[model samples]
Target: MLRIITEPTEAKTELERISGRTQGGETLQQEAAVREILQAVKRVGDEALLDYTAKFDGQVLKAEQLRVSGSELDAAYHQVSREFVDAITLACRQIKAFHRQRMPKSWVQFGQDEIVLGKRYNAVDRAGLYVPGGRAAYPSTVLMNAIPAQVAQVPRIVMVTPPGEDGKVNPAVLVAAQEAGVSEIYRVGGAQAVAALAYGTKTLPKVDVITGPGNIYVTLAKKMVYGVVGIDSLAGPSEVLIIADQQAKAVHVAADLLAQAEHDPMAAAILLTTDETLAKQVKQEVEQQLRNHPRRLLTEKAIAHYGLIVVVDSLSRAAELSNLFAPEHLELEIAEPWDLLEQIRHAGAIFLGNSTPEAVGDYLAGPNHTLPTSGAARYASALGVETFMKHSSLIQYSPTALQKVSNAIETLAKAEGLHSHSESVRLRREMDNG
Candidate 1:
């Protein structure tokens, strides 16, 4: 059952204390393991990748067979039901539309004196997307990570995922990749796959950027390879914060909270409301809902560890407490959601009204589901086309324009005692005079 707190001071302290516990210590042994895997793959290339595939995944694959074939993708489309195909197609359209609207475009501005300054946006050469596989297969992740890169016009999009014991990639994942325009696929995963993408293997070329969610080893590998290749934000465990009021349904609030809790044992599910009765009702509903969930054990662990229900003095107080938590997903279950939107200063994604659930944003909603986790909502944003593109500022100054700023530049250079910097400007002035 979720814990309930009434006092404001107690609630704040409890939240902080629980959050600290959730951010637990790592094993130095785990770091050493990941480092060894990364270095081996970096040194031996495809040979090391094949060995790790057999050792970790229990499947041995040839270098040529690393990339999934077109026939396999075709078979995947046939294997899934028509309903699923239609759903995936619909999601693809929505995701593409949302990212297309936000696609960055190159721009140039010119002045009367022939001086031009602007920005040019270019997509990365290639991107590597890591999709988690095993008991659960998330085709949605493939679509979310690959579609934005496609929309950004990335020339090559490569996907890496662990193969099953049978040495076959998930058909649903493959189909989603094909639909989302992924040109390459690799049957490798974990820190070794991350290393291959960061520092090219013989079979897998290095990518300009890497994006997706994975286990702690994958997250740590991305952190270690920051300088070699760009990466999406270092995502932590999933989290959801729901702010409800007297008008909110207890069942709806509870269901949303459990949805996040089922993700992982470290995930957080929090509820803040002005009505004590509603908090009590939702707490009961959560227990009732947990009994029916298939992942009840995992959800129960998450709830017992990180979940909370706080009954605040007012809705304004609830929002204030929420901003401090900076949860990854925020749901406004109050009467006037838009009115309270201004009060929400920190959250990776916000779902408005009782009908708008966090699950909608996770799969079918147009917004990118790859979000900052833990308390990263304080600064980071959801993954989008911007994550796959680089921006370069353009500056052009004619002789007259250079002449206008030359004295200012020289004066600043002189103040710093850099005579050579001033001399460069003086040389230009003399050349123009001649």
Candidate 2:
């Protein structure tokens, strides 16, 4: 059951406990396992990927079976309904339009002294996207990760997901990948898959950047392989903080909390409200709702450990607590949601009013749902077109432009005690004079 804490001190303590969910002795052991898998994949290549897939996923496959065949992608269309096709198509359109608006354009600025400087943005050569498969298939994840890379015009987008017991990728995920313009896919997953992308496997080529969410093993592998390649962010378990007022419906708030809790056993669902009566009602509603929930076991586990409700004095206090948590998803379930939005400072994504549920953003609200979690919203942002691309500083200086700045450059270099730096500038200036 969700506890209702009225004391500010107790509320803060609960917050600390939830925020530190993924830490401790358990995570240390998990990291060791992830490290071993990563090292084996690095050393053995395709042999390691197949070996681990057999052990973990209970599927045995050869090198050729690692890559999903084109026929499978084509057949996937027939498996899904026409409505699904249309829905995925609509999601792709919305996601593409949203990201296109944020596309970074390369530009060069020329100055009066023949000095040129600007930024040139270009997509990475190859990007690997990891989409979790098993208990749930996330076609939404496919669009979220691949659409941004598509907008960035990445040359190749490679996808990896765990195959089912039948040794086949989910049809919906395959269709979503095709819709998002990601043609290359491999039926490999877990830390070994991340290792294959970071380093190169005989079957799968190395990728420049990897973006997607996975289990603890996948997260650990990404953390370990940071400098080896680029990663979007070290994603953690999902979380949500709802700031509700008198107008907010108890059932709706309860549902939102459950939605987050159902994601993982460690997922956090918190509610901060001014109405003590409403808090009690929502807690009861959560209990009633979970009675028939399909994911009741894990969801109940999450709520029992990480769920919280704080009865604050005002909506401002709720927002303050929400900012402190820096939740991945923040919902303003208030009558004056727009007004309350100004008070919010740190949140990965904000859903305004009682109607705008976080699930909308999760499925197809056009905004990428792959957000910074575990308080990462305090510093980072949601994934977008920028994740797959890099920028280089474009610089050019004419001889006269060099002449004007040479003395300043030389003086600065001399101050830093770098003779060669000054000599290079002195030589350039001498050539101009000569």
Candidate 3:
């Protein structure tokens, strides 16, 4: 079902279209709907959350039942197998270890003139983690979002996920949350859940930052409430852009592409290679491998609409097209991956060589898998410890230091026609001089 295009111009067009897949053609309507949900939640609080949960999720819940019970979290361990618990524990340790390496420290710089300047970093008081529960319970998402907050030492990490038709949260999600140091779990989801985290209800405490990925409504809701609270990124569907060569195995490359396509019908998988033969083989392999796949219907739709293959003149050209695409996940399947890695300028996560696949990063590879999608890699980055923390500029200017720069500051402030700004500095200088 994958289409192969040799012409460079057509490849560029297809790549652009695929990279912008989350534009959501009906924007005004969707934005208005999300805005209404946010406003309703903001106005009426938990009542609105209950109403939307019942309407959208088809599961009616009361105020007291909004929070997942402590017994439920304990029973989650009993429901999952020992293997599941062990695997989740292993992933939790790996993710925590990875983020620990990225922890940033507060640093202060001293100058000869005694002008103290530094940056102080502190974790937000509370953080909200949203885990999607539509197609499947994404325990991986819980690990990815919660571990970063834990590494940042966020005081309180609260998780919100949609309950199923049975009015119960997924056992796997609860187990993963607990493993990631999050004890507070709420069973509300969709745009309304975003509202609760942003504005806070009587039962749910407001969070300083919200992280995780969801559907269109959840994405737009995050966008709407961005000013009220910080968010990881306006995450789009999963995507992968791979650059392969003649030596790259067709089966392996095809499997990696399908790995991304299986995420959603809008997910994109693109392949660029100098070898026309390899491109065609990968194309054929993708179709062959999709035969009777569990997610065939959705994967086929993704391939038919967003999948693409480009036969370039050289590996350099392939890298050029890849940088233009700015994919969320980039895999270099060339003979010398590091050699071509020099040409890479934009990508959220990079998988090197033929031995490494994007799947490793998705699981226990020790990197946050919640990466920027839909060409957002050009400006955004993967969710990490920085997402749940903020920094303030620490400044302390001694009287002598202020005197040294007072004239410059006063001149600049007066030139900008703000006397009050300069007067404050002028008074301090005059006090020390007098």
Work out the TM-score per prediction: 0.97, 0.97, 0.98
Q: List the residue pairs that clash in candidate 3.
A: none
Model 1 lDDT at residue 249: 96
Clashing pairs in 2: none
Provide the lDDT at 236 for model 2: 89
Give lDDT per model, in order: 0.89, 0.93, 0.93
List where candidate 1 sits over 4 angstroms from the true fold: 18-24
Whichever of 2 and 3 has more TM-score, that candidate is 3
lDDT of 2 by residue, 59-112 (tens): 999999999999999999999999999999998999899999989999999997
Per model, how many backbone clashes are there?
A: 0, 0, 0
Per-residue lDDT over 265-307 for candidate 1, one digit per residue giving the tens place of the 0 to 100 score: 9888999998989999999999999888999999999999899
- Which model scores highest in TM-score? 3
Of 1 and 2, the candidate ahead on lDDT is 2
Tens digits of per-residue lDDT for model 3 on 1-434? 78999998999999999987777644788889999999999999999999999999998889999999999999999999999989989999898999999999999999867888999999999999999998988999999999999999999999999999899999989998998888899999999999999999999999999999999999889988999999999888899999998999999999999999999999999999888899889998998999979999999999999999999999999989999999999999988999999999999999999989998899888899999888889898999999999999999898899999999999999999999999999999999999
Off by over 4 Å in 2: 24-26
Query: Candidate 3: where is the Cα deviation over 4 Å?
Result: 24-26
